[model samples]
Target: MAQSGGEKQGKLDFDESRIDSGIDSYKSISREQDASSDRSQEKEKACVTDERLDSAYVSSSLNVDSLGDIIEQCSISECESATDCEYTEEEVNFLTTVTEDGDTILHLAVIHEEECFARQLIDLFSPELMDIQNNLYQTPLHLATYLNLPSVVKGLVKKRVSLELQDQDGNTPLHVACEQGFWDCANEMIHNASPSKLSCVLEAQNWRGLTCLHVATLRKHHRLMRLLLKNGVDLNLQEGTSGKTALHVAVELHDAPAVNMLLNKGANVDAAMFNGCTALHLAVGRQDATIANLLCQAGADKMIRNMEDETALDLADGNDDILALFPFDDIQIMGRTVMSFS
Candidate 1:
């Protein structure tokens, strides 16, 4: 049974050769698998690039369609008289998307005074775009106020469009209505807006810390001023930065009507400004003798001084008539009191 040692060793060598051949076969399979993995990764990358290209193409085509639609709409006069053509729901929806400055169809329709288009837009797209803000942070209500379209403003308010919406400067629709002197739009806002919402409108300050009253006074809009004052706006409210009251602005603007309105509304005639200058001082320094007489008649103190301690007479610059308005006892005119000036 014991074979020769050389024959047994030869059998062992043959078994080792078989094991080495199996190992070489496994290595070749692993190399092929790695190459296949690389090819699959390349195919995935190609797919991503193709998808991006397809997206670009689709976007380009949509842009072309949008431009073409705008051009066609401009050239055609059929839409001018909205009664001539009835817009389908789909067509109205499309118009809603092609907005100028991010405004919806309802916004443009109301602004352009297109009564028929506005009605159709409200009937169809109001639920979708009623709350949309244009690029200028103006809602349809704000636009309506700016354009003095009371009908559209009423319709939007009746539909319960947001009255509390703010623009970029945090101004409400009422602010726009008041600033533009649109009494009808202002009335609509005041009537339909809630008490809390109205508070925001009345108190809402622009970037200049000016409430609606401040704007009305600056523009010398007497009607708007009366409307705001009647609506409970503070008559003596001072600007946050300038500490100037509506009376001060009225005096500066030389608007006799606005000044009288403010004075009658119980505005402080002698309220000092940021620099400690009163309306009387401004009226005198600017040579507004008429406003000066009004201020004096309203009991504005002639001795009111600025931060530099200069009185209204000090600012009169030798105007004898202006110097005579102040009681000589109250004002030191040329180092003398009323005894010398009169």
Candidate 2:
């Protein structure tokens, strides 16, 4: 208590330095604990985040795999049973190619006569694939007609498939049905087609300029020809290249029934080919006396010659009926008449 001024000042300075050092040490220890706690919290947070991410990834992957598996199972089961199975929108949309030639499932189902499968597929994905063309540029209806699947044709018609759709050869469904002798299919098409579409069906020609009637005649489908004629198919419509009528096709094929059908339908027997040879010429060349008589009765000109100046009599190949039927007076009259007309 009785120290000198200098001693007292030195003692006070020592106490202050000791207090400052203790304070610095306390702050350093607190700083170290805070750093350690922060590291632990960061690690815990990282662990939780990693666990959540892993769980989400697994859930997503499982969902995708499950969907894929369901689709594969459904397709396999349906195909094996040869029947259509009920499927949701998501199920039918599963990836499946049906055609061996890159046709869609709908196309294959329709063409192959898989009724159930076609129905199921149509109900699901028809809006998307109904209009899709195959590698041959054929629609589902085209394939259906080609395969002569009446049920499939009816189904497609029920779904309102475009009747005017054409294939690569510019053939409509009616063209195909008629060409393939699918009379019922042609009837279905005729019944469902609109008035404006009727002309297209009647007038649809193939690469050879053969209408539906020509096809029916070529196939000797008399009933189909009658149906087409009843629908107002032009009996005199000539082939574009050969200029041959339905009558000509019948005579060429020697199809007596078809020829009779055409003649009965008012087919012009006298309609000449490009070389001015009538159906009688063809019938006579084939030695078909019955057809020759039928054409003669139908007013076929016997004296008409081809580009080689050979008449049906000359081209008769020694058929006595032709030689006997063509009387000399009638021959002279026909020649004079044809010459006068020419």
Candidate 3:
């Protein structure tokens, strides 16, 4: 049946509108499919990257174990030379690669106490590799000293590994030895290092502002103290925090024997702190009669005034034992209360 022109025109317009709507829907679906494909590709790429990293990590770890096997098979005693031990390119590369924790092969070897392997690695590797620090900035020498492995220390020293490299706490290998009281390791480092290097190591203050001598005294390591003294450490070297010398530290700790040792070693009895308080001031302040007596006998100035302008006698105002050590005249004049030892 023929329809009227108006009806036909209306039908055509309706048909065109439906066609336009269909095209818009098709375009939306196409855009969605493209976005989905891009997301899938991205996921696949991420997976590939993760797999590579994992594989590399695993490979490097396996190489570390394999290196240990090589060391075992060709023991130091049997191996003609450290360089004679054959290594594959991969194995050699593993020496330079660090673990996630930033420990190189040499660090792991020392931590595991593979002493023989450590010595071999020390000999085989260059100074750069031998001295590579971990995340803690702890060199192999630092670990050897901390672990008290004197032989490993000797190996590192002979190879000229830097003795001055500090850990996270800014402690050099020598500082660690003195703090830990590892006599043999300390001795090895002290004697092997050149005179200039030894002096530098001794002078370096850690983050806590403590030198090797200060640490030894604070820790009450008498033998180590003696070793440091014998090595020519300044008897009156003051610590950074309060300018307290080893003598001041001893008296404050109530260490009679250490006080006597330092005095005999030529420690200045009048060496004052940043506060101008002598060891005697510390002794009297702490009410330590024994140390005060030791300092007095060692010729400590009883009248040395501190930054607070309080003499040892003033700090000892109420203590009769301490007051008795001072001359009657000085106590009467300077002390708040007069007490006569005679």
Candidate 4:
């Protein structure tokens, strides 16, 4: 049966103007036209009538036998046509069916911020159904995390959905939370996770070879970093491309505070990249004296060489301040040690 032309509570119109409203709603608020203006009143009434007629036509033509038939025709119908339909056995079946885009009703519920409906769907759907990925390869939990929907995130987490499920970017739901700096969502997911499972997720690297900690550092989400660290995320986990640890990334970004935080968290001060260049090598290469000093204070080995056989001292040739961070006497000592070894 077609949903009525009159609006249902919390149901949004799916007209062209509002087709992408679920995502656009977060971007900005649309200005309302002055109601007292005669032209505005006439335009509003016309829009309402057009929408109702369009919805009625689509609903009349909607054939429910095939999976896409109902949704394809109804996509232009009122939002309630699909979401707030009568709870018949057929409607229940449609709720369970995966749409052509790979979305379940659960995914739509999260997208629309239909909290009460989403919670009811969560209870009705099994963990497996909740984990269904759409064409974008995002699960409802992934969408919830991305959209910063904490209550929905909590509901999904409580349902024990697979947090390890990675989206197209290889970002697990937790990775998405950290990437987007959604602290509440990350907190809910982590707190609800078992210790062993949490460990796996904390270490799960994305396609960029970045773990949740790496993502937090890249995004400059200090609070999220602390949260992951507190939950036992490895500070020294490296990215796949360059094998740069969070400290390496921080140093490269010249984020003194992040470097300091990672240091205090016991990140290996001299962790080297895949190229055999330590974080100190990066600091010296960039000639960042403050970071060089910080690394030296943290006991970064000065004599470490990269694949290019360039020591942090070798890279610090022209910058006196950075060179001074490694004492002249220390350079002589390092030189003699190399001489002796050679």
Candidate 5:
């Protein structure tokens, strides 16, 4: 393999041609252009880590009998003594290593939650290490967020890990934090991120048609919901293929806090789903009187009909208390009066 030495086999991975500054692509994976889809098979018998590269060197240049000397020096405890643990001149050439899945040591360390181990490696390595992608195309930040490891999340952020890398599902770590309701992790990202990164997180739609705000609301995570609102997410952004806003989701879940928060934030209560059922209709149909009353107080259109031309009152089965709250005669007059004023 040394006979075929070129950029990948014998050069620094971060040569001038490789590292594009201010960009957020994975691993600075300009390294990707060098590989075929079969790179995994190609890398199989090659020097995997510097550990293996040293072994290959010892076996080829000296003798296999000296292999134990290299192993004993590579230990964490042994590495504490600088003179005892220093790599040979050849070993330093392959210092950075990758797992079979294309994850750097940082990716593996964060995934396995080796806090002290990962921190030591991170402090020694460049922040660029955090940006490396695994076979799944998830950076350490994405993995850390998925695992809800806030310490790792903060450590990477402090190191200036690129916040923009997405997994195959188009989820940034901030998106994962919000979707998983990892509020502290999400908060760290929100407060610490660059304005552009924060905006990206705020507007990113996941595979499920949920932005971070929609996920927070759907999960009824009140603190996260308030945080998103304070940061100014579009309150009425319709979610999913069904065109349901966060308010619609809250109504169906009978989540009064989310419903009230959304209403107070000026979400359009009459915004209909694909079936033309307004928030009021959902609240009544689901028989959540507290949520229905909250919506009504927020000025939900009581007489707003579905595509079937059936009003929420009409959908109110046997629940006279719900029917009585509608004020059918009064809402008609009030609607007509509002239309006249318009």
Candidate 6:
């Protein structure tokens, strides 16, 4: 199924005009499923509760799979049944039990995409359980967003789970979603987020000092890039470690389309990175005529120099097409100072 006639992330080739309706339907399915699943769960809650087999409990980072298997086993009976009988203190404790790597049962549920069991756990546990951070410092909400499970995402959101909490690497759920190309999840996180959360989550950076936009660009997620831009992200924001703007990434990767899109969206064509390398310099160096043309068309200043004091013209080498974007006489102009320049 195509979404907008464009092949975005291998999803349906849908038409841009249909985007609103398509997303509306897409989101509607998630909501409808959640509602029906909730009602079905209500019916099960009235029935008998299944006890976790003793084999289901374990305490080992190496044994997470074993725990995941046991929980998968329990999910079969518990998630489908409506038994209201709550978890025993010991079972609850087991639910909260963390491996050396710090994953709770809730984390596993989201990982396995066991939506029913996950929601049931959410219903039965204290709100604090949702906030439990694993060894990676990812809360259940983070796991759900990273895993791109809408049901689990909504379950956490329904509880008003904290959205602004940063992981060990300093990424909020928004960063995880954007970085991983989970567009729908990103939308859900942003749409449901409070204004304060929107600010913090959008601005939050990972260890590399990359906002969600940087990751989106680095990963070539066109749709995600638009979503972030539509949400009012700072386009000129450079990577903390690399000091490269999104345009620099597109040009370096030889992604002409991304270069065009970023330029249209207001990415500074002449913006420099950590080494002071601008997109124009990268485009010329890469011999990407299309991107070089796009940059020129967008009014990229060919006169800008990197820290190495090299302009796009100086690095064009034998690529006459790239060399042509500059003024015809610029070479002669640079020649007078070329010896002193390099």
| Candidates' C-alpha lDDT | 0.65, 0.63, 0.73, 0.73, 0.65, 0.68
Worst 10 residues of 2 by lDDT: 19-28
Per-residue lDDT of model 3, residues 4-71, tens digit only: 65332111011111111111111111112223233444323322211121121111222322333444
Taking the tens digit of each residue's C-alpha lDDT, what string does model 2 give over 1-342?
224553321110111111111111111111122222334443234222111211211111112112222223334332322223333344344334333344565664453345555665554444346767765667777877776777767767766677777777777888887777889888877776666777766876777677778878888777788888888788998878888999989888878878888888888878888988789888888899888888887877888888778888988777777777676643346446433211
lDDT of 4 by residue, 1-342 (tens): 444565333332222221221121122222233345334344344222111211211111111112122223232223333334334454456567564556676776565454666776676667888988876688999888877889888988888898898888899999988888999999999999888888899889889899999999999999999999898888888899999999999999999999999999899998889999999999998989999999999998999888999999999879988977876533346446433211
| lDDT against true structure, model 4 | 0.73
Supply the TM-score for candidate 2: 0.63
Sort by TM-score, best first.
3, 4, 6, 5, 1, 2
Decoy 4 TM-score against native: 0.73
lDDT of 1 at 64: 19
Better candidate number, 3 or 5, judged by TM-score? 3
Off by over 4 Å in 1: 1-100, 119-129, 168-171, 330-342
Highest-scoring model, lDDT: 3
Best by TM-score: 3
Query: How well does each candidate superpose onto the true structure, as a TM-score?
Result: 0.64, 0.63, 0.75, 0.73, 0.66, 0.68
The local lDDT score (0 to 100) that residue 123 gets in candidate 3 is: 79
Better of 4 and 6 by TM-score: 4
- lDDT for residue 180 in candidate 4, whole number 0-100: 82
**Clashing pairs for predicted structure model 3, backbone only:** none
Candidate 3, TM-score vs. the true structure? 0.75
> What residue runs in model 4 are displaced by over 4 Å at the alpha carbon?
1-91, 330-342
